[model samples]
Target: MQREPQVVEAKQQGGSKYRYRILAMLFVATTINYMDRSIIGVLGPTLIEHVFHWTKMEYAQINMVFKFAYALGMLGMGGVIDRFGTRIGYILAIGIWSVFGMLHALVQPAFGFIGFCMARAGLGFGEAGNFPAAVKTVAEWYPKKDRAFATGIFNAGSNIGAILAPLAIPLVVLPDGTNWQFAFLMTGAFSFIWVLVWIKIYKKPEEHPKVSQEELAYIQSDVEEGEIEQEKEKMSWAKVLPLKQTWAFAIGKITDAVWWFYLFWGSLFLHDQFGLDLHGLALPMIIVFLIADVGSIAGGYLPKIFLNRGASLNVARKLTLLICALFILPAMFVPYMSNQWYAVLLMAFAAGGHQAWSANLFTVASDTMPKKATASVVGIGGMIGALAGMLADFSLGSVLTASGKEGYVFAFAIAGSIYLVCLALIHLIIPKLERAKI
Candidate 1:
């Protein structure tokens, strides 16, 4: 039998706990990233009704600009991180996004909607770097067995960010939407603090003085699964883009549009259907994302349960994804509910399910691809997901303009059903989650 790594023993035995610090930083970064992007969403209804007075189509166009920029950023940022390493790559990303995020305050009414789109596009591009750097960081610091859980822990930050938006934004922006610009400025400023700490604290696991031999061994235990043949060489998209494994990962990400819808439009839905104002929207929105936070952590943990029970990695990952998809099926009924809280409950399940699904879906890349290529593959998948979001935004914008509240039925139905289809397609693309030859 293979010997267990000494780091698995109790910390009193001198096991180093430095990797958890890395995970914590990732969690904070993700939280700030989501907070920066989600500010617009939390302020959307107010902006549309009281401030910008934008039509549904115009609002959709603004979102489309962000998605388009995000899609392009994903394509490039993945390659940049893969080439430069996560440390510098992450700094560059956060720096760009923070500047643009704060610039939202500068968008004058004279510049009109075009100004907001410009700021959002910059924010989108910078925010695109987040997952690529984060996933690559996880792959560097944790073995495959722990990666999903680590991912889930950090991924939960998205929900926390979403939760914080309604709670905090209401405090910054008045009920009538005065001082709305402060919301973006305040949230965007957080990264400067994070960057200072990150610069001092971060280094490769092997190189970091705080990471002990036993802990380093623990981190490297599964390295052979995704062999690092050219550990120092940069991965080219030419190498990974052609693989079925890459497509499997990308296709699985098509459901990201659903998650984006929840983040960007869920509050609006609540406002329109249930007549909830900023404060009234808080409790339901908080309830929805808090449940999602649980799902994110649980989603990462569930596969470990299956793994311990003697299931194959392929089976554990796919089965967990299946459970998550089933949880989302109730979303179709969200638009039909007579009670607002009932609708909130159902929306919570769908949001939670998506977070769970996202946690596993992210691990699929590192599970199958080389560690060097993790960011690149994740970037490719994110780009595809962003493109999918753009398409959804276009459809939603046009439909809501023409049909008003009725558009939600179509939206919920798609969100409820697409997961199973994508899951089916993922299975068809990669029958087993074997490591890619690349």
Candidate 2:
């Protein structure tokens, strides 16, 4: 006998599996975000130092510009996202960053060093919206139990972008015998294409025409109806800043500089330490980020696994963080290692540990804060993290100029120890995983 129309609709609603499709979109946007951002670091040794005859300090100053603007942008864009909603905020962000990414090609010697600084600032400003939008989207689409895994899946795109840049840039610049301009232009174009797809397809679970009732129920399964309605109300920074949960998240993020150092300086470290040119840098870069990719996905999933096994969210999350922190301890010895590959191996674990740590750290924002306030909380934390990166860039630049290879020892030591300290602070501020009162 044929099923009734109501029964068929019910079955279809229950069977619908469309959230992954949106997660895939978030993953792609993150991939493009990192690709555009990392291109400068990948090409800095060849283009900035050798081709343009820029000094290390000058290069660092340029990075300072990017970090400074990124810090401010995080603060501003966080609010923008919370106010405007993800669909509009995300498109505007990618569009702005893509234009600035392409504008790198137009920066000429005649326009002077300040011209490049301007471009970097613009890029940083636009790219700031990425995480706020992504985390908000995750918070919107997935229930709490699945959030860490979902975040980990999309967060791995950073490693993918980091991975792709080394692979793709070699093809873009080397094949033409150093048309670095082509690289910026090529990577920048990706975001433009992504924006079109996002516009056509993205909508909230409740609002999307294609989302079935069963899927919507699954999405809302973990959230209380009271919280769901309240999440739509606006939350101001004044209201959010007072919460211990906010401080715990922000304090933990202060160590974010350690990861930023790995991205911005790892290539330079290889060039200076091992006498490896750009081509030789690719394999090690690939190794570091590939492991990071594994770490990102695994780190996010581990918490879910622990939750399934009956561990408390706090215990599972913090236990994973402790393990990640221990894994990074070997990085302190990277500058002292005799063999290049040994150093490479150690840095790989450290980079991987950071990615794992980051995936969980991002989830904390959504896990504790009200959905309406998630982006704002993330913005504040990101601003703190960006400030730490700014300090690293300036200090590391000076140390490198003054001490050459020996300077990296201090950086490595700091990177190795930062997480333990930050983790301790997090535990102190928020003894439990209770959600924020907001």
Candidate 3:
């Protein structure tokens, strides 16, 4: 009661320390969330040998089913997160996906292929909620200005999960080489640990007693002018959907799919090219992906460097993302490589570069949207991205596979170039990096 300004000042000085801890649980949740999804990619060859006797076309169809379901699911989940709060929506998402992840191992009948597809669909459906919920949570918990780095940290979870899979999936195998079941089960079960961590640790700014008033004030300081607008904007969905914020998110997400395409198909590309057996080429590629993990965290830190140089947030974010996107172009050379190690160097860095781009792109979505509607916008874009990814997958097996090795090189080139095209489209759609004028 002494003075309102003094209260805010005191809290700001102390409260900044707590933000990382608050975000740490979200980081782990994202890690486990993606870990569950990626297990299949790593276990693909084993699953074919042990479980379903899948033909190539049949396997493609199986993926198509999951993609279709996941696309629809993403559309629905984003809207739901808009209406509901982040915590509850996130819990529901993780709950269903994790359960199905384990169930992938339990299904029987060699011809019960549809059941496996359905389970994959369930995993896709559940995971659809991940980004929308996570983006929303970031929008809710962090001020607008700080979101990019935070988003980068959470998005890096994909890399972390992908990195771990080579070791984890192989470790749980049976001697006879039939035990892909334990890999799925163990990965799925890992999500529950994050659930416990998230439930205990997460809360809104005002709701957390440990969050001092000063800290909240500083957290809100850059965003103080919009706190009322951000809070008021949360009232409903219709008002939020009509603005440029919607497009900003959609474009960024569509671009995001390009990276996912690289990750989902990368090892397969190696296997296809090198006649990779699990122990040789695939292991090296996994090591490469694991090595790429550094780029995720590094991507976020780049803009902070710009900020120290006194660039505005808007300027710093765009410059950093554009630079990251540009790094992807060199990746087109992978298919041309006669040497496998050179191929590894090119592809891993390119994928890592994409993560760096991805880490900043999400910040752009938050940069352009008010907190209230961030989930819906992210959902729509992510939905489109996933759908586009499905098409890309089809193209990979069908079009890219046709030319043999050169086709593969061209495929990597196409993949590399997508981010810059995405960035150009982003510039056309909403040139300035600010919240939309709606």
- Best-first order by TM-score: 1, 2, 3
Mind giving the per-residue lDDT tens digits that candidate 2 earns over 188-222? 66787899899999988889888887777777776
| Among all candidates shown, the one with the greatest TM-score | 1
lDDT comparing candidate 3 with the true structure: 0.71
Q: List the residue pairs that clash in candidate 3.
A: 11-214, 11-215, 12-214, 12-215, 335-409
In angstroms, the error of model 2 at 14 is: 4.3
| C-alpha positional error of residue 348 in candidate 3 after TM-score superposition, expressed in Å | 0.9
- For model 3, the stretches where C-alpha displacement exceeds 4 angstroms are 1-13, 49-51, 174-177, 224-242, 400-407
Q: lDDT of all predictions, in order shown?
A: 0.90, 0.87, 0.71
- What residue pairs clash in candidate 2, if any at all? none
Cα deviation in Å at residue 292, candidate 2? 0.5
Stretches of model 2 off by over 4 angstroms after superposition? 1-14, 110-112, 175-177
Model 1 lDDT tens row, 1-438:
123644354431576879999999999999999888888888888888877788888888999999999999998999999999999999999999999999999887667499999999999999999999999999999988889999999999999988888889998898677998898898655899999999999999889999997787778776663255466887899999999999999999999999989988898899889888877888898999999999999999999999988899999999999999999999999999989999999999999999999999999999998888999999999999999999999999899989898999999999999999999999999999998876
Candidate that beats the other on TM-score, 1 or 2, i.e. the better one? 1
Clash number for candidate 3 = 5
Candidate ranking (lDDT, best to worst): 1, 2, 3
lDDT of 1 at 272: 87
